[model samples]
Target: MTVRSAWLLPGGTDSPGQTREDTRLAPVGTMLPDGELGTRPGVIPGGDPFAATGAGAMSLQVATGRAQVQGTAAQGAYPVCLDAPEVVTFADGDAQFDRIDTVCLHVYDALFDTAGQNLAAVEVIVGSATDTPTAPTLDPACLPLWDVRVPAGASAGVGGIDWTSALTDRRRYTAAVGGIVPRGALSDVGAYDGQYADVEGLLYRWSTADDEWQLYRAPELPVETITDGADTATGWTLNSFDARRHGRVVQILGYWVRSGETLTTNPNIADTLIATLPTGWRPVVLVEAIASNGYGFGAVAIGTDGKLTVRSWAGGEKANALEKDTNVRVAATFVQ
Candidate 1:
């Protein structure tokens, strides 16, 4: 019973954005119950689905088919999970078939916001590795914006930019020459949902006829900009879009806040109305990590069970009341 697609439902059928009768056959090794789900559970790879080699563990999750990863601090022998390029064998025979191919890998993380009801921001790490991660290839799906003459020996992360820095220097970052730049002290505004969520923005996706990764602005965010600020960006270590933007820093900003809080356009977690939430309800928020200094996406929270939630709009916008008990943490990353 090999699967063609895989999904990660954080909550059961009762969860928001998920229908009561939501049961789809995923690729082989699709419905694996926790434990371990990496290509080599022990050997860490350089690319995505990399060897879960991090000593410090964080609870990570992504919606089925979605590329976003959510996490919380975990105290133990950390067992990291990589953005697996594809799934091979289930290892366990009880799962029926052996190998399965995955079109997308969506994970979910709830530990970051225990309060569930009031999570201000979160850090979402997305991988740009290709469908085959074993022997990695450079897939510039959402290249980060960076300058040329990049630091000697400096390599690129997902989408083709280098972000391996304690403090990203914004000096190297240059915008499209003229436009309204974003606010904040070193914010990394992304377009088409990058590997990391550090600024308030949207990541609409598109593909060229040739299958090249062509990104569109999130429907909610209609306006964007990237003035001549690469030098300021380089100072922040802003580099990743080179593969796509070719040194032009494109910024995603101005998302339409519906009902003063929730988003106006994003896929529901579930296909049916049963799992659908009201028009004005946003499960998570894209915020900056003020506590951690620098600019990283902040997160919002929805409790495990028996709770209520709502998103707090920027400029101190109030949110609508969410029904309790059926707390469904609905982010716009659901791919089904």
Candidate 2:
């Protein structure tokens, strides 16, 4: 067999002085080795150099600047030659990935600080370019300025305005502004209730029934009946009576009916029967009970010891003239 190596020269054309033989050139594969032909083993363009035919040694050195590249390889492992972008300097911590469509980076307990102080104390950043961070401003009025937390297995309570803690066992904090301005229902004074701090023109308390704190004011007194030592004989009864205190005066109004025996005088009757009277106030000639008929009349007088005496009197300046079958209305007022 004869072998020939043919080289084609450029700018050759069949026209003018160019020959036809110059335009004709043999393929480079015609000179390839027999084992490298076709798609069989050891073929030049068939098998991959890094795979079935065994990979060749490759060493890369990046001195300065950057090299841009792009490509893809197997899924699980890193490729021998990574496709990169135009500017990539590993020493300067700069990297670019051309083939990756998206990249995600996650950080745990990431700290950003200036002069060793937390970033939260410094300027609040709103947006981020690489990590996509975000921050939202909060409204202080929408939340409590301070919250008191009762730790587990511990108890905590806030004292009212001017409320003093026990000297030995309690911790106290005095607020210049009295207690909290309660909202909702109000509570009345009780045996265990503490004194409220003086507000210039406001009052507040806790309503045990309503289960909420509320603004409060002085309440009206309720009508209470004289339950004990009341006359309950046949046809003799004391009807409903109302008693109330307003500012410095206490008032009582009621009616009683008697049909059996004539009434007698007793100095301690008012003190014993009317337990609703406020302290330090004795019935002073204050009680006057007159019957519906013009025949019966009664009177009450207070002694120096704040005790009262009840006596029946007549129209002729006679005393103890109270007769049977008489209905008398009694009304009196006292300074408290």
TM-scores, all candidates, are: 0.13, 0.24
Candidate 2 weakest ten by summed lDDT: 100-109
Candidate 2 residue-wise lDDT at 14: 25
lDDT of 2 at 54: 8
lDDT of 1 by residue, 1-336 (tens): 211122233242233222122333222222111123312111121222221121111112221111212122241111222223222111121112211112222222244323232111112222223332221121111111111111222222212212232112111111121211222112322222222211235322223243332333434533333322221111122221111121222222111111222222132211111121222221233322111111112223222221112322221121222222221222322100
The number of the candidate with the highest lDDT is: 2
Name the weakest run of 10 consecutive residues (lDDT summed) in model 1.
288-297
- Residue pairs whose backbone atoms clash in candidate 2: 68-85, 69-84, 312-320
lDDT, residue 140, candidate 2:
16
* Candidate 1 off by > 4 Å: 1-107, 114-336
Best by TM-score: 2
Clashes of 1: 69
lDDT for model 2 = 0.27
